[model samples]
Target: MALQPLPILPIEVLRQAALSRLRAGVAAANAPDADPSALKTLYIPRHRFEKLGPERAPLLHVVAKTDGGEGLSHELPLVASVGTLHINILLASGRAGAVDLDVKAAQLTQAVCLLLLEDQTFLEQFAYVEALRVSMEDGIARGDGGEFDVVLVQIELVMAEGQTQFEPRLPPNDFAQVDMTTDIGPVVGSDPPQDHTVRLRFEPEE
Candidate 1:
């Protein structure tokens, strides 16, 4: 049989795929609200998150790094890679005319989880999603500025394809013949031992 090419999903591709879908979802939610304080931006930070300022508030940070694989076994060619994608929802606690930071965090977290669940296209990019979890806490943002309420959402992908390296092709099974022998018990006094032997040809099955 002809060998087939291996399947692979580069890490960058997975990260970007998730970022695009999330950005789209946030945009869709923001448009209808039409409120100046409504969440506006979702992005993958190019610099250290601590260096970012308050202007980046009402933002979502998508982090997709760190993963381990179900290593290949039994001479299998490939295996799945699994990991978590973290979405950090940040909002300024004291922004004027805005809802309570706690309320905003809950709303944002709900929207994020719903979008990821309802949007089937997102899952098409990977093998499958294992589960999603969310938590909230206070965090310092942008130098010594006021604390921002943060919501963390973790999405665990059970198995993603194309992330593992493929094993080299196995050599063909080729053997020509087999030989066998059996030892028999000796008689009470005279015979030391008895033996039986046989040989057979081996042919590859069609």
Candidate 2:
């Protein structure tokens, strides 16, 4: 018997793939009316939030980032497991033209969600596990300025492992950790295979 290498993809490659697709989706929706030039899409490299000035109105900020993914039971020819990726698509508009911006943002959100939910492979490699449209109040916009209404479209992806990156863990609650070290195999070395045990954790996120 032999072990086959797993199919892996660069994390940045996957992130950009999702970014481009979403940009296209929003672009296709247009804004308010049939005017294709009515909407503009911008990319922010950091995971933090940013404030949009009056000049940046009628613009969409596409932010993409990822975290370490959990592993899955894989077989031969697939030595590694895919991790979950989260991409946040934010829709924003300045206070001056805020009325129409809301409608436009909603439309863009709809388009992006519909395209992602399609029953086809994304990035020509990974299949999206899920996508959600959530509303974020005050947190995303920093700096003291007229409030900016932002709509968040969060997308989840499962792709092959890449460079290690981890999501900020809510510090472990005041609970003792369990020893997951398991013992298994034949009894040749005085180790009983049938007497093996497994552990499980069901604590809620803090």
Candidate 3:
């Protein structure tokens, strides 16, 4: 027996795909031929991320948020899903630099969005996408002894409907033996009350 397949649109898988594309995009954008951009990308929970120090500034974090779906038709095993993704870009404002942290955040945010929307491989993850919206918010992330400028990018995706199938788990040895017996009464005009016995045996299919 083979293991069951996972959901066609798993949130974790999508999150990883987003991260891969972003990392590649960022690396390409900051290639040796171009001006280097200092940044780190992560896919982790908020609590764990809070433990990081200011040295990890100029970072990009990808987080998968809410997800929901609906059946395309009552008669079919099809579903239409929507997912929310967030990218938090942080830049250390405390660092002494000529460039403004706010401006840097904005630039980084643009790069993230552009990569997500333009990447064909990322877009192919959805079957039939109806719509996609990307929005951003500027704020500050206060830490134990410092604060960093943050650009929060939110992406809402309305994916196309797809067929869903369920598979049952089978035991290691799923063989069974079946036997059945039936009692039949004598014909209507039979001499006396008499019964006949019929036995049947079932076998597994080859």
Candidate 4:
């Protein structure tokens, strides 16, 4: 018998799930009085993503500074190093096409935070922890008409000695190094190939 392919959710579904995870983390960090039950009903339209691409945007592309908002400036106490995480999600027309989602760094950071919360053991392995910072940078185009949605997530582990203050700093490269791969298979009824789930793994430099 032929093997059956696994079911993959829609891109919008995945996006909403990711956003939910982000909201949960923010609530846990701050606003203990903030009702999570009410928060779940909060829905930010996809159009808000456009604000993230504008020049001189705020630290995080979130609408408010509340716990449910983007946790961009929250600092984590590190032992001896600075750790930075980034998450980027893009929805393009198709492969070989222009990038519709241009916020690369910020998206990566968000993904990293989600990953950390899901697995606290991974965080303990590191020596130091500091403020979690995320940024979105627009990428240059190689061609016109052609477009692709790409999500890049990155985590940076900066090693340091004892008594080092973990300040929120941007990577000199403007963005953390990233490796992209598909977490979920192609969509059920899509032309060509469309990955419903994209996974980005981040490893700090030695």
Candidate 5:
């Protein structure tokens, strides 16, 4: 019997996986100790990102901006997602400088890219996306706050997501069937050349 392939993930799952991984990467993240707890994850509602309250000097925000693709295609569910990850670098005194931010952002990018290349991450599926990529978009100043440098990471995710099935294990077969063959009737061109028949029967050990 032929089995159906697993269903592909919905658009939300694909987009959300991208966002979640990025956020999780920065949450209590361990890297470049000079910026400890400085490289934290940020999440604001799409409609209110611009209205975020007083955020710390150094913070990273990950957002899934758009989900656009053939919901169901290629006999499987596929999604094209675009996301944004912003790294806020503190430019004020007694805090991290542009160099520090650059180092952290580079480190963060490497970590997230490794995640994207994975087939299933921590029980979530984004399966090896051949078309996955991250773009560094233009950064701007946060006019509402003190000296802050904005670093944006434009995330593009494209992959067919599916679940994993663990099949049952079967016991080994130790019995081998024995077959017996017999010929009925004389050989061809023999006396009268009677009809010939070869019969095969399987018999188990008594």
Candidate 6:
């Protein structure tokens, strides 16, 4: 049998696409009862994490930065594990509106996982072993912000080998690190929340 090439996607491209979908979901969930304007902006500060060990191990020092020129801010840990990619989101702070932002955010995370698995290129490289592992730790916020404290969203991706008997045979397990950052610009600071949407695409890695 001819050897097949491994499937892969540009980390940044995938991250952006996932972020866009997340924004869309958030907007849809928070649509106004009356006139609905397009979702204009989203801001995802630079986030970082430290690997603890294996799948069971916990990630440490996950942080999110804001353009507000504040000191390094931290949030609860969120983790996700796919084939080989582990994703985590740490939310620093957010404007609490009427909409269930946390639930919408979780949905956004799942959407990203679905996209990664459905994408043939990504699957080829890192087969969809199972739903990405997700965890949302208790978050905290500071300053006289709106409603919610800085929410922390964390995701972790794990790559592992699987049985070949399955229709989609598992590929070699390897580890790679990728960072996803999203920026939704300012929105009207009001009640009932504002609606915002963004579309993003993913491309194969070169």
Runs with alpha carbons beyond 4 Å of true place in candidate 4: 1-109, 143-206
The candidates, ranked best first by TM-score, are 1, 3, 2, 5, 6, 4
Task: Identify the leading candidate in terms of lDDT.
Answer: 3
After the best TM-score superposition of candidate 4, give how far the Cα of residue 47 lies from its true spot, in angstroms. Answer: 33
Q: What is the alpha-carbon lDDT for the whole of candidate 5?
A: 0.46
* lDDT value for model 2: 0.48
Evaluate all candidate structures by whole-model CA lDDT and list the values in order: 0.58, 0.48, 0.61, 0.39, 0.46, 0.41
Whichever of 1 and 3 has more lDDT, that candidate is 3
TM-score of 2: 0.44
Best by TM-score: 1
Each prediction's TM-score versus the true structure: 0.59, 0.44, 0.58, 0.26, 0.43, 0.36
- Point out where model 6 deviates above 4 Å: 1-84, 91-96, 127-131, 143-147, 161-206
Worst lDDT window (10 residues) for model 2? 72-81
Q: Whole-model lDDT, candidate 6?
A: 0.41
For residues 109-200, could you state the per-residue lDDT of candidate 3 as single tens digits? 66666777788888787666666666667666676557655555555655543455444554555567678999876656657856777899
Tens-digit lDDT track for model 2 on 1-206? Answer: 43332234344555555555656655555555654532245444333356545334334443334434444333222223345556555555545543554565566555555665562655454533433534533233432566666555554555554333334456658865544545564455453445455556555545
In Å, residue 181's CA in model 1 sits off its true spot by: 19
Encode model 5's per-residue lDDT on 124-179: one tens digit a residue.
54433435565664344644555455555544555444443334464565557656
Model 5 deviation from native, Cα RMSD in Å: 12.3
lDDT of 3 at 168: 51
Give candidate 6's error at residue 27 in angstroms.
15
Tens-digit lDDT string for candidate 1 (30-112):
68746543335554454335556554566666665545577666665456677666666666644333547677667667767
**How well does candidate 3 match the true structure, expressed as C-alpha RMSD?**
6.9
TM-score, candidate number 6: 0.36
